[model samples]
Target: MILVQYMTKSSITELTSNNKKNKVVIHLSSSTKLGHYRASCLILFAFSCVSSDCFGELMEDLTVLSPKAIAMANAVTADPPGIDSIHFNPAGLMQFEGDTLELKLATFDLKNRYSTGPQQVDPTVKASYENLTQSPYPQDPYANQQGATSEPVLLIPGGSTETVPFPIVPLGGAATRNAQHQMVFASAVYSPMMVGFSRPDDDLGRYQGNETAISRITYFSPSFGFQVGDSLALGLGINFSYQGLALRMENRAPQASAAILGGLLSGVSGQQIGPGPYDDVATLNIAAEDYLSVGFNLGLLWSPLPWFTLGLAYRSAAKSNLEGDFSMRYSHSMQELSTELRPIFPKMEGVEFERGEVKMEFTTPQHMSLGTSIMVTTKFKLNVDVQKSFYSEWDKFTFDFDQPLDYLVFASLLDSDGQDESLTLQRNYKNALSWSIAAGYQWDKSLLLRAGYQRRNSNIPGNALDLIIPISDADFYGVGFAYSTSEDSHIDLGLGYLVSRYNIDYGQSNNANSDAPLDLIYNPYAYLPIRASTRAFLLSVSYRKPF
Candidate 1:
């Protein structure tokens, strides 16, 4: 029988129990011991934020906040976009002379693709794998040739991983500039980082990440702006957010150690380790949330010439220690192996289903954006922006389990500093630079047309790429139209499409290939080249009026 304990410390509830085995977290503080704040229905509804887990792999410009911004491909650092300027360039808030309210809605149609080539491995390892799975009494014939799955999956907080339907996300904010017109104040709600995905229990991609992995990062900002000089504007914003992460994935030991064990088992007493080293031996499901994530934004705008405007914005970094529940189940094969090893290895502990509190630390890298807008003519303007992210702060993720883990015990053989109560995933991401250009045409007194293109660079090194978080350098194209509904009210409509692709050679990705001995949970297609493609379609609609 398995036991589990649920803890709620956010004043909504509280508890303590020893049920089974549980593990979690990169952050554990008084908050970890204090409790969880049962979120409202709204929080649950918004959990379906985006599928691009931004914790460390932040795609800073999903820029999903404003219709005008999206339509201009997020090249708004110099021109700003309604209340959403709190993120692009707070200084732009000064442009509003009185109280104004804006509403926005966005939708994403995301699709992913995967393909595999011939296996590329040392001849000896290949022989061992083929012998154990192909020439054996029981075999997985399709093991050598895996197919592709375009279906998308999502993590259901209180439930298991499941397929997701079309999702439309609602986002917007309100802001006002006092009568003095020298100062401006505004607030808005938005999503800066988020992503999630899932695969069938049998999908080959499951080997890299099975089930569903999710991340929720949202922001509510209150900002202030000052017209320092006729041509200079400054702004400051305090951003508070709710950050949560939930994940469910299968685990395996696909290194040479497991293949060797498989070969030995095939010739010996026949105690099944698995069909091969590539099979699943354990599964982990964890979920946690941090209601209070804090950060800030600073911005400046300068118009040195009537036709040229320059702007700069800086976004601060944040750290969150999420608290949540976790459950891990060890397979019967693993249990059997534990039982057999107990005689000689008296220190080994037999493991079963475990449930307990867990903690994980997450970080949002600091970043800066600079841009310029030039009015080529009274009716035409061009905007260009450059952005830099210090993703080097995201070196690794540390998951702290409430109890010792058997997998960690066995993992120690391959790793020199393995700890039974913790596991660290090394990302080794690099700093990235991205840029965009946009043009706007005032065709009529009440009609404006805008078009833009953006280049998004990849932060994941070539060796760290994987299907679960399959990101590559990408291109974003956008077009938008703004129409004046009345003198004080206007309507904006935008459409955007983004495309990215990756072609990883056999054993190129350290995260999913068998070329690395440290590859613990992945390597189902160790020797096979991989191809991945992603296409995202976005639509935004907005209406604004003075209040």
Candidate 2:
């Protein structure tokens, strides 16, 4: 009824009331058609969802953890920061002597939006539905709408998963010279991704997902940097990380197959008897975490002359098996429909209240970068970096359920590539190449001015883009500065902004189709062209002190 009200834009008055059964019928104006279009493809997310495949790769660390890194657009490969060198280029640690400690704090403010584009439906698909249904409306059922979400959430596996204030991540590391070995040892803590967002239960965008957050925290990173030669250095780091994911989405299937079947049957039965394409059948909430995950990084730095230097680094790939719990709450209408269809599809056992343990297979691919830094003059320096992430390493993701979910079994029957206990979804992601350029100038003996820009490429192909993690090619612009408090101690502050926007044509994304003969997932806006965007503002502060 709410969907009807939103689409029809009519004031609904009481048509009839049955006090005995506590029932009320909505009266629609004569001009309003009872057409409620819902070609929605509701997806489950963790990178995928509880009962479907949807999420793709998430945002990387970028330069958020480093004030100078962000200020310099992550072009610091050739001129790594003090102790933060453990991440950018371990070899840079050799530049530090004696004891050094660094602390960093960063906050992120993000915005996401989705809006419907001009309607353009397939002639055959539209014609097929109109011909089969007895009470047919020629107009498109799914109308144009705009959606927004502001509430962000954080999930603690096996713990309280609550809504929190915007995230303020703290990252730091310490290192001391090992003169005897001519090597430097250090460790740090960081996260690859930790952001979440939510929408009101009745928000227009609830069909895609209600709340979602994916976290990859590196709790421990042990690193070593060795001075191999007078002008060369080598480094390696081993990282122990934790991965967690949380998602809550309202499920709906507005596929042609389901809608066609319902349309044909409704005509025969003289009424709408089962779930339609746009009906919100259920809500699924998933929380999973992996306590210990491992990966490694390597770095090389060379400086034959004080005027120029080159640096290279690689962060190894890793796999995680996040385990947790999931619950699916079915609507009363869906429950009754399942009961009526039980004779045929017995697995539709009315999953009004379903809970179980679940696990998923996820992979984080390796990353490689090459950078150079040059001192253009006594007071000016420039840094440039080229980076790549092997997202192509991702192909398929498997979701394992502790029990054979009856709902999954039924949902799988709609698609051939699905399984009862373990559901595998195809994910053909491509590698992304990005580059950055940054420059710094000494304003005076006590201050250094910095500015940088980076071009970030999208890993997901246009055909696979969806709202779960709708990251796209983006532009990152930043500015910051460093102030010398003492001869060897400095403070760094940076402010950065990034934006990624995409316009997905109708029927372009795989996540858009469920009725398509070959599809693995479903979304609510399948039939509508979608405009999605992400904008983020970052502020970072760092203090480096010699002990």
Candidate 3:
């Protein structure tokens, strides 16, 4: 049998017995005499908040990947397209009458700033039993006397700023043969969506999330386009994708408080040790191995008149089952406490609390796009595109652990019934629509100039505002120029700017005071109000050649 025990101050023992076949056990000890149970509970509460909160956004497909497409805010659906049509509108591939090759490169300079209001002390410290009595001499003298107290609120002093640079390269090729009766075949390797960021350990939002690294989500698409007459064409493609991710964050435990506890443990073990200044923080790191998934895309191109063209495309959602390992590491202080307590707690000694396997289910949202192009004259053209992202499918994110993390003091206090724990974060995301419009002028056949504007709506609700991605509705403005280098070769260059901002205020209710510890932690940022904003600049270049 597996036995777990909780010793209360009244010399009462609460015993929880389980089958020995179970691999994990949890124990909680509270000394009522010294009023240490309250301290332990507070510590556990912080742990509960840290263990449950995880955040990220699905914003990859929203980014325009082609130089010319981005130059016009991705309004290329109805325009005569090149290799990039594999992603924007494969049916446009029919415009290519011969073998074609294209290479595109893009860079993003992104900046984010976040600020929070001043921190506030926990309200419990201000509570006093003396309020119940008016007597000059109270039963507890120290009850109402408050000179100095513990500051549980962790603050970054000021705010924080993060700057990151990202680079992307996309390659594509297409071929047409007369023997196939006006059919075009194309293949491309590109990233439809990719997002990542990292911050320092001392960042103000460290408790929320410090780093998110998604190396790549590469798509290998092979497509076919058929010309059914001169006015309309159809295309279909299969998209194979590979994805990888690594997420890391610091837990909310104050190292100073943990070190003090460790010193007390050392004294109980008949050792002369004091709390160390360096031993007070903990971090949890999770990394997912690369995984593969598949999806499909379809496109249609129709020109009803000599001066007007319409295009439609749909990209299916891809679901990925990410498997990885999670590891928890403590400061020197926690390691010492675990060492001393292991002897009295034999069950804890058998379990490896440092590492465990984790599984996460993620889905890339689907997209539907419609576009139209009008030729005002031979030298001037106008284009408009509308897109809808089905983000309602991403309602929540859950991470499942293969083994229990009993080493966390709060895990034992909050939920001790199971050896495997599942952590779920509610997203409640909603579907969003985005649109773009652009105009292009052909300055002779050798030069073309384009400009456009776009707006993307936020999928995250105000109640679910997150610190990791800090997503918000954004506006994009762009300009570009395409130059013909030779009879069969051309180069396109584009520049764009994106801007967004959000206000965040999660209330101040402490979880330690909750009726049920398992309930979600609320008002985690009650002490501080947040203002988050993002600014990014995009530069892109593409080279296309006919062979």
**Candidates ranked by lDDT:** 2, 1, 3
- Specify the poorest-scoring 10-residue window by lDDT in model 1: 33-42
- Give the per-residue lDDT of model 1 (tens digit) for 89-167: 8899998878899888776655666777654455554444454445432232223544444444544434345555565
lDDT for model 1, please: 0.64
Task: Select the stronger candidate by lDDT from 1 and 3.
Answer: 1
Question: For model 2, how does the per-residue alpha-carbon lDDT over 292-380 read when each residue is reduced to its tens digit?
Answer: 88989899999999899999999888878778888777776566656654544555575578888988876778889999999999999
- Candidate 3 residues 1-547, lDDT tens each? 2343444321222323234553324332332111122123223323322222222233344344577877887787787457767777878888776888777777665556777654432232111111111111112111111111111111110211223333444555555545367888888776665444666655655544565545334456788888988899988888776655555665443112232234344433223232222222456666664447788878999998999999999878877676766666665544555555555444444232377776777777788899999999999999999988888887666667676554533334334442335655555678889889999999988999999888878776665564555567888788999999998888998888777887765342232112122233322243345677777677778888877
Candidate 2 residues lying further than 4 Å off, grouped into runs, are 1-58, 137-142, 156-159, 263-269, 411-417, 513-520
lDDT of each: 0.64, 0.69, 0.57
TM-score of 1: 0.83
* TM-score computed on alpha carbons, candidate 2: 0.86
Model 3 lDDT at residue 385: 92
Error of 3 at 201 (Å): 3.4
Candidate 3 regions exceeding 4 Å error are 1-59, 62-64, 120-179, 254-281, 332-353, 407-421, 506-526
Better of 1 and 2 by lDDT: 2
Best by TM-score: 2
